[model samples]
Target chain A: MNGDDLFSGELENVMRWLSTAGIVFALISAGLIAFFLTRRPGWRMTPPAKWLLLVGFFLLPSTTMLLGNVVGFHRVKTSCAECHVMDPWISDLRDPKSTTLAAKHYQNRWINENPCYTCHTGYGLAGNLEAKWSGLRHVWHYYVAGVPEEIKMKRPLPVKTCLHCHAQAASYLKIEQHVDPEMEPQILSGELSCFECHASPHPRKNR
Target chain B: MSDPSPPEAKPAPAEPRRSILALTIACVLALVGLAVTVLHLAWPSPLMFTLFMVVGQGSFAAAMAVYLAVILVDLRRRKVL
Candidate 1:
């Protein structure tokens, strides 16, 4: 199936319902735990009850996370739009005629589904964890501290993300500029930024 | 004169062992869950992701349930229910 089809009506609806149910379950479980803890009964919880509570507590977050991921996948555009700051970038991506690197990539489907996530997420285990943590921080900033007017990446994008696709590709390797033996060290060491030559994928003007 | 006091009962020997065993199982399960989650995040295929979501989270949930059960049983034994 096409990537877009994954977010189509029926699946999206199912994911939304599941997300809502998971949230309700989590809240109820939390409330029960709170009640159990705060109640003025001298009586201790039985072993079975204690185990149930423990399981319930673990399940609350775990289930919620699973559902959250699924739901987030469906609402990627909407969730990103919540900050309003990403409006220009999203619009550019959706624009077929746009010439920006990111726009070209999106329009051509160079990356797999979820173009934003594909580019933004780092490589490997640590990179993935970092991405998830970064996402959480973004949510925290959006909800609690309020996103800054000029949103910027916390750090420079890693060259590895680019290399993950381009390094071995015949088209990329065929380019003379990419094959400069002298430049290889600089590229690997990150002394030279990829964007310097290629230009910013998402141009500042679009923002 | 004060009446003779009753002797304190000895705790059951089996209880601690059971709790320890349950704790060990929980720890193992939690580690497995964590590993699966990390793997899923790294590779990110649909099947792997689904497996991670189910098995990883399920393991944690099961571990917690086991611990809670142990606590409940202990409470019952103490007549604190």
Candidate 2:
């Protein structure tokens, strides 16, 4: 399907998930209230009950967000270590491997701290920025708003951000050996990000 | 020991206070969502359209309805005929 079709389908799925989650949240909130009421003898719900229920409401979303943060942190750490460099960030990345080639994204400067979402847009279990913003609007999302309403805002790295430090010393023995056309029209026109084609940047057999 | 007024001691029922506040917030959000939706329908700017549609104005309506339902349930439980 076309991009528009794909985006629409994805949005429908997202709304369905939100509906399910909202129902679950409401159910759990009610269950906790029931449990709390049962626990207290002759509990006519003193002022403390209000505070307790409010705290639980606050904690519900906060705990979910904290868990999400942990998972995101873990993913970035692991992904960065797959083919990271021998440097400060890479050294501290989740898992380090000296054996892998230098072409990995872990070695890339942009992905160093940013991780997968840095390029891969959209929210899911991982969270994604909606297509409501893209193109000039995306630039505005970063530059104008300064703060994205839907998702966390990340400052755009320097021009040629991904390639600036990535196209550096190749860990491979033969540096010239590569795949895909070294140059593309899209790149010259600044129409595409490096991740569009060279997502992982791993060299294949043919260019 | 001091005698306490029924209003002070009873505290106007927690259910009504909580439900009213939740319902009011839900209503206000629903109205804002609706306003955004109307504006998008008229002007159709990308930004405004995004604000209204993808954010799901309908979702806000649904939330308000749920809050109203909760208030009804609480009212019934409290036996306010």
Candidate 3:
């Protein structure tokens, strides 16, 4: 999507506000920790109280980080949908008239909820981490740097993601298009793109 | 110097060495876990991130297990369980 289409005015404002708030909160937390650490002898806290405060100081940021991860993991789709840029894509998935491969997979619940993440994220542990990392980077760019004019995938969508589900599907394997041994090898090796045949994978408008 | 008074009749080692060892291991595991988690946050690569998550969380679990073992030993020693 074009930069403008990638992020709407409302989304931009919300992101700016969130980022500013995050910075403010971080500063406040650091200041409090510093204040506690630099207290004078006469105003010294009791040993237990001092230890408790020190532990809290150390735990605060880590706790915040963990909370963010947990929230992102569970609410990925909602978080992604917050950016209106994805709205059209999500809507297209739900559009009954749309016959794109993506739309069919999404509408049919073949991949379940968060269909965007399901197809986009790599498979297994490494894939999950990569997706999370990419997501964090996306947030950083959207909030810290101005959103780019063109939003592009970091890499071509991996064939592995497609094969993860379809490889084992009896119906998929039985299909004539997938029956050719040469075609299977080529597709598996990434020599061929799935979209080559599925030309209207996400047709912008229904035909 | 007067003969070292028969080594001062070394006092019996009352504190449970096993408990102390377990607690020390727990603390070490916890610190390593924290370090891994911080690394994951700072410079995340896919492999490192996966390793950190597995090892980091595993360390925390191991620490808890060690602590639990200590508790169980203490309870048994005290005849409370």
C-alpha TM-score for every candidate: 0.57, 0.29, 0.53
- In model 2, which residue pairs have backbone atoms overlapping below 3 Å? A122-A128, A123-A127, A123-A128, A124-A127, A180-A207
Q: Model 1 — interface RMS deviation? A: 9.9
lDDT of 3 by residue, A4-103 (tens): 6545576444444343443343344445545544555323324653453344333443453353244325445445656655666778778998888888
Task: Specify the highest-DockQ model's number.
Answer: 1
Query: Candidate 3 regions off by >4 Å?
Result: A1-39, A42-50, A59-64, A147-150, A204-207, B1-81
Sum up the clashes in candidate 1.
12
* Local error of candidate 2 at residue A161 (angstroms): 5.6
Lowest summed lDDT window (length 10), candidate 2 chain A: A198-207
| Candidates by lDDT, descending order | 1, 3, 2
**Which parts of model 2 have CA positions greater than 4 angstroms off?**
A1-46, A59-64, A70-188, A191-200, A203-207, B1-81
A1-207 per-residue lDDT for model 1 (tens digits): 676665667765566467566556555555555554454333223455456455545665466557646654445423454456678998988888778889888888887566777778877777766766676567557656787777677778878778888889899889877778988778767777789788577867535
i-RMSD of all predictions: 9.9, 12.6, 8.6
Candidate 2: TM-score, chain B only: 0.59
Ranking by TM-score: 1, 3, 2
